[model samples]
Target: MLRYGLVVFIALLLSGCEMFGKKDIRLPIDVVSLQYDPYNYSMAELDRNATAACIAKGGTEAVAVDNEINTESVRWAYMNFNCYR
Candidate 1:
C-alpha cells in the first residue's frame, strides 16, 4: 500500500511538470529585469515587442540604447531600452 501511494504521488507530481514542453522563447527585452537581447527574435519583432511592452507599462516609446553582457556569458545586442514617457 505504501509503494502504491508513493507511485501515485510521483505520477501526479511529474504530471504537473512540463518536462517535455517547448523551451521558453527568448524575448528581445525583459521589461522587469531590464534585460534585452536579439537572440531568436528579429529586429522588427524585437522593436514591436519592446515598444508594446514599454507602452503597456505607461511609456510612450522604447529606444534601444547599448549592448551589454551578463555574467552568464549571454550577449545582449540591445542591452536595454530607454523608455520615453
Candidate 2:
C-alpha cells in the first residue's frame, strides 16, 4: 500500500508540466464580462463597449464575442471575453 501511494505521488510529480521543477509561474489573464439587457443593447454595441473596456483595462486588442437574444422577452447576451497583458 505504501509503495502504491509513493508511486502515485511520483506519477503526479513526473506528470506535472513545469519549469525549474520548483514554483509554478502562472500568467495572469484579464477576463472581462460585458453584460446587457435585451432590447436595451445590441450585440454589436455591447461588443464595442467590451472592446473599449478591454482597451481601458490594458488588455490585448484581441476580442471574441457571441450574439444571443431571447425569443419571448427582451434580447440579452452575457458577453464574456478576456485579454492577455
Candidate 3:
C-alpha cells in the first residue's frame, strides 16, 4: 500500500509539472483585427489571411483571438498579434 501511494503521488507531481511547463509570453505591441467573409473563405483560410495581415502590419507573431458566425452565413475571425524586436 505504501508503494502504491508513493507512485500516485509521484504521478500527480509529474502531471503538475507538465501543466505548468509552458508560459505565455506577451509582447509590447498587441494588435487585434477581424477578417470577415460571406462566401469565399473557410475558417482556416480566414485565420491565415488575418495572420498574414497582422504580420504585414508589423507583428512578429499572430494568434486568433476570437471568431463570430453571423446568421447570414458570414464568418468572422479575430486575430491578436505580438510584434518582434
Candidate 4:
C-alpha cells in the first residue's frame, strides 16, 4: 500500500509539470494580412508580394498562413513569419 501511494504521488507530480510548465511561454509569430483583386493578380503573385512585405518588415522567413477569396469580389492572403537578428 505504501509503494502504491508513492507511485501515485510521483505520477501526479509529473503530470502537474506537464500541465503548468508551458505557461506564458510561446514562440513569436509575425502575421501579415493583405487584400488584392484576383482580376489583377494571381495567387503566386500575391504570395510573392506578401513574402516581400514580411521581409521588408525584418522577418527572416515568410510562409502563407491562410487565404480567402470572395469569388465575386476580392482575394485575401495571410502570411506568418519569424524575425531574426
Q: Which is the leading candidate under TM-score?
A: 4
Give the local distance difference test score of model 2.
0.66
Report the candidate with higher TM-score, 2 versus 4: 4
Candidate 1 vs 2: which has more lDDT: 2
Candidate lDDT values, in order: 0.63, 0.66, 0.61, 0.62
Tens digit per residue, CA lDDT, model 1, 2-81: 99999999997887676666565434333422444546556676667778878888776777766544536666534466
Please provide, for model 4 over 1-85, each residue's C-alpha lDDT reduced to its tens digit, 9 standing for 90 to 100. Answer: 9999999999999999898885654343566666665557676776677677667877654566545556665354333433322
Q: Can you write out model 2's per-residue Cα lDDT over 7-41, one digit (the tens) per residue?
A: 99988887784533667443536767776675565
Per-residue lDDT of 21 in model 2: 69
* Top lDDT prediction, candidate number: 2
Better of 2 and 4 by lDDT: 2
Q: Report the lDDT of model 2 for residue 39.
A: 55
Better of 3 and 4 by lDDT: 4
Clashes of each: 0, 1, 0, 0
Model 3: lDDT equals: 0.61
